[model samples]
Target: MHPAPSVIFFTVFSGIGFGLLVFLGLDTFYVTGWTAFVFFAIAYLCAVGGLIASTFHLGHPERAMKAFTQWRSSWLSREGVCAVVALVLMGIYGAGVVFLQVHWAILGHLGALFSLLTVFTTSMIYTQLTTIPRWNSWLTPLMFMSFSLAGGALLSGNVGSATVLILVAALIQIVLWLRGDGALARSGTTLATATGLGHIGDVRAFEPPHTGTNYLLKEFAYVVGRKHSTKLRIISIVLFAVIPVALLVFAPFSHLLAALAVVSHVAGAFATRWLFFAEAEHVVGLYYGKR
Candidate 1:
């Protein structure tokens, strides 16, 4: 479970895009049907674009089709399949809105439902990875849901209450991350246990297998100093969560202020996402040379 920036960007960016699409689809049921349809189309396109960009990080991109073979046991496979289903649904819904003049109560609702299911599938991709203790939590899905909604709200030009909710969710995630760190420290385990250790104290990495950093070490084994991590955590909570919420709450009630809040929230979300990846200690890291 190395921190793949490509995958990370894909997840976060596409989460935002799909969330916005869901919100727009939901709005189609209201008086803003045409506007909602336009936004939905744009959001769906962005999500698909992000998905395509994610594949560039894979070494064997040509073999990406093989990912769908393990749907029975692999969450990643399920995610891929679900993403395809959601995209198809959204495309049909968009076409109906554009050409057939379809009502929102029918196709729009179906699209929204599929979008939500897509979010669930996407969250499960990380949540199912038990080797990453930080991600193996109910909060992972909750965080994904909240952040998606937050991004959607911002994109839809409603940054008032949604930003506050996002802040609250981000705070909760930060607390959960702290708890996870404490749990890992108290587990009384070492890198050896992660490789293949049955007894408690019979785990130690006296000598690393390699003298220089390999791909595994450079990826999964990356670590930040405790002091820097703590500082970054505080900054993430403040700049990404608290301050943005404050701006959304009381930012002179001007369009310019709302726009600024949206920008701040997006930037903050990206930073928070990065920390989420950086702070996570994959069990695979133990197999490498990380402690």
Candidate 2:
């Protein structure tokens, strides 16, 4: 599948934002009072900002309202609705934490549930795309959920716990990507299936679909060499997951290191996420002249 930078930023940035909200809600649940209100506010802002940034990817931003019309069948529509609901609930949750103070527990629980729902909605956006085999996995949602938790923990300044969780999530994502790649390499199934050809026999594209790249090719035909992808995977694991875990576990507690680890994880995760999109063999690519 082709990786849209806007979509990638949307997922990563919004995941972090929503993740932070989930953590803040959790903090309210266990730690009490309005101390976590500021964090919740930050979480809400990030979530909104990420959502807005994603709009830049649309060819017709004016038609964005049409997205909500297909919520019955479209995961993208559902994601939009879910995001709005999550934001609204977060607002109410924040209000309760600030003013009501009495229903923090109730609102916190609701926020956590919505956070999980938000992750599910995000995953569905990919998983429902039968055209993208790499994303059609139960692991996709888990990866999203794990990353959300991992990011939330990191942003919350609980480096030790976040590091452990992020590593676990990163390992899972790595395994899933490897499995998807192997499937693509073996059957030629990816490109074939994407083009609606079910046979296992050899297939190749001889003529180009267009003189210039179209939206589909630009968005889905992205390719990266296997060797480079492998190197990036290793780097991502180390920089985003393993090393951060080590630093959080062993290094002297310093805000700088914690902050750096977050930066590294975000950058590394973006790379990993890009690889996820690039390495994916879209069924559409077969029709577009890729073997």
* Candidate 1: Cα lDDT at 91: 74
Q: State residue 17's C-alpha deviation in candidate 1, in Å.
A: 0.7
Model 1 ranges off by over 4 Å: 28-34, 98-101, 186-203, 252-254, 287-289
Q: Highest TM-score: which candidate?
A: 2
Query: What tens digits encode model 2's per-residue C-alpha lDDT throughout 53-115?
Result: 889988899989889888888878888887777787777877776766644666666777787
Q: Among all windows of ten consecutive residues in candidate 2, which has the lowest summed lDDT?
A: 27-36
* Candidate 2: segments with Cα more than 4 A from true spot: 28-37, 99-103, 185-203, 209-212, 224-227
Per-residue lDDT of 148-178 in model 1, one digit per residue for the tens? 7777777776666477668667866776677
- C-alpha lDDT of candidate 1 relative to the true structure: 0.70
TM-score of each: 0.85, 0.87
Q: How does each model score on lDDT?
A: 0.70, 0.76
Residue clash pairs of candidate 2: 2-219, 2-220, 194-283
**Residue 2, candidate 2: how far off, in angstroms?**
2.7
Clashes by residue pair, model 1: none
